[model samples]
Target: MLNVARTVRCIDDAACEEVQLFTEEDGEPERLGEYRSVSGLRIDKAKVRDARVFRLWGYHIPIIVDEEIKAALEANGIVGGKFEEV
Candidate 1:
């Protein structure tokens, strides 16, 4: 099993639309908007420099993996997960 070390947010330039942002209230912090679809997603490399695996902050559906980990998984013939470069 793979474990995520942290979560990172997409950069401002990410191409997405119709995102719904939830305002901070009742002691809860403001959350990033939810995207039905996103393209040109870019993350701050500095934030994930030490992380081999991580999920997108606030949108945990995409599992990001480093090149080394991707290679290892491919070499091992692991299946079920589809990979796309972000």
Candidate 2:
């Protein structure tokens, strides 16, 4: 199973005002997507949704954010924070 750390960091690859998420699959890092944001570090819900960041175990959207962010995302109809295999 692939696991991404909850910590978010900024990439310094000359891409300005955008955040990039690189997914590690099979020991290879692939560019998931690049999202444009005002601060470029604060990942918003839409970008998360677009990137499908919560998905794991073959398309299940897992809860990956903290309570406050989880609550806010849930309020907006995004399900996620704790995850388990069934």
Candidate 3:
């Protein structure tokens, strides 16, 4: 278990061109098919430095977390959520 406290921060300098913008279909809001995959995700680490948790603009389905948070969750036996590197 991590003995140190973790502070979550939010930064707006992250950018990912690979993610497709969400769109509406049949009057229902939906994300483009491409957004379903996180392959080729490119985020500028310098922009989001020190941020332990954050969500990208226009895409909120997956809440991004840093290594510390990930470890904490795993150490506590968190379930029902998938963790993928950005």
Candidate 4:
């Protein structure tokens, strides 16, 4: 699960489509009830402006974001983890 600073209920696109999520590791995704079939396409911080972090289960994760998400993490203790991208 992503430990995003904001209390995210879900990840929705501009169209409000729920982004399909899957697991590359284990346990985490299942915990948050998120299942997406990802291609391991990781984005750099430079391109993470549109990204939003989510928690599959409970494993705190860092995700892409513009200003809002970034501020959220920094404001929350989760950012103290000093975690980068996966």
Q: Write the per-residue lDDT of candidate 3 for residues 1-86, one digit (tens) a residue.
A: 22333332222223444444345653435534324434355556676767677765444455777899889999999887688666
- Model 4 agreement with the true structure over 3-72: per-residue lDDT tens digits: 4564333333223223445454655754454534333324333433444654423223434454566677
Candidate 4 stretches with Cα past 4 Å from truth are 3-62, 80-86
How high is each candidate's TM-score?
A: 0.63, 0.22, 0.55, 0.24
lDDT of 1 by residue, 1-86 (tens): 76765877754443343343444543335543543344556666766667778887766777998889899999999998888766
Give the higher-TM-score candidate: 1 or 2: 1
In model 1, the runs with Cα more than 4 Å from the true position are 1-5, 10-20, 23-37
- Model 2 spans with C-alpha error above 4 angstroms: 1-63, 80-86
Worst 10 residues of 4 by lDDT: 9-18
- Local error of candidate 4 at 43, Å? 8.5
Residue 30 C-alpha lDDT in model 3: 53
Error of 3 at 50 (Å): 1.7
Q: Regarding TM-score, does 3 or 4 come out ahead?
A: 3
Name the lDDT value of residue 3 in candidate 1.
70
